[model samples]
Target: MTDDKSKRDFRDRNRVAGDEEYEVGYFASKFGLSIPQVRELIARHGNDREALEREAKALGVR
Candidate 1:
């Protein structure tokens, strides 16, 4: 369902490879989410860590 452009956008925005805060396991644990869930969050939320955390909290996650 995801297009290549969207995949590129996710990667470019999230920058997870070198950013420890955005790493799958770390982000997932921080938000009490699975890795895939974290990835989906990043994709949907444009990879802003603070914003994602706020959104998660607002959504009653954890």
Candidate 2:
């Protein structure tokens, strides 16, 4: 029997990966904010996905 765990989508959606440039870029685009803004949110919120999202919304996505 072969283990097919590699096919699983193991990404943790509850946390933002600050070190991943693509992840940060995607998050920024999703909120219509700049990469720097998302990065700053990650830094302040410690990558908590919901917190960053709330902060991003409070900042007013444009």
What's the TM-score of every candidate structure? 0.54, 0.77
Give the TM-score comparing model 2 with the true structure, all chains together.
Answer: 0.77
Q: How many clashing residue pairs are found in candidate 2? A: 0
Tens digit of per-residue lDDT, candidate 2, span 2-55: 335577775677888888888899999988998988988887888888888899
Off by over 4 Å in 2: 1-11
Backbone clashes in model 1, listed as residue pairs:
none
Candidate 1 on 1-62: residue-level lDDT in tens?
Answer: 22355344454453443234446687677767777677667778766667777766765544
- Judge candidate 2 at residue 39 and give its lDDT: 87
Q: Give each model's whole-structure lDDT.
A: 0.62, 0.84
Cα RMSDs, all models: 8.1, 5.6
Report how far residue 30 has shifted in candidate 2, in Å: 0.6
Best by TM-score: 2
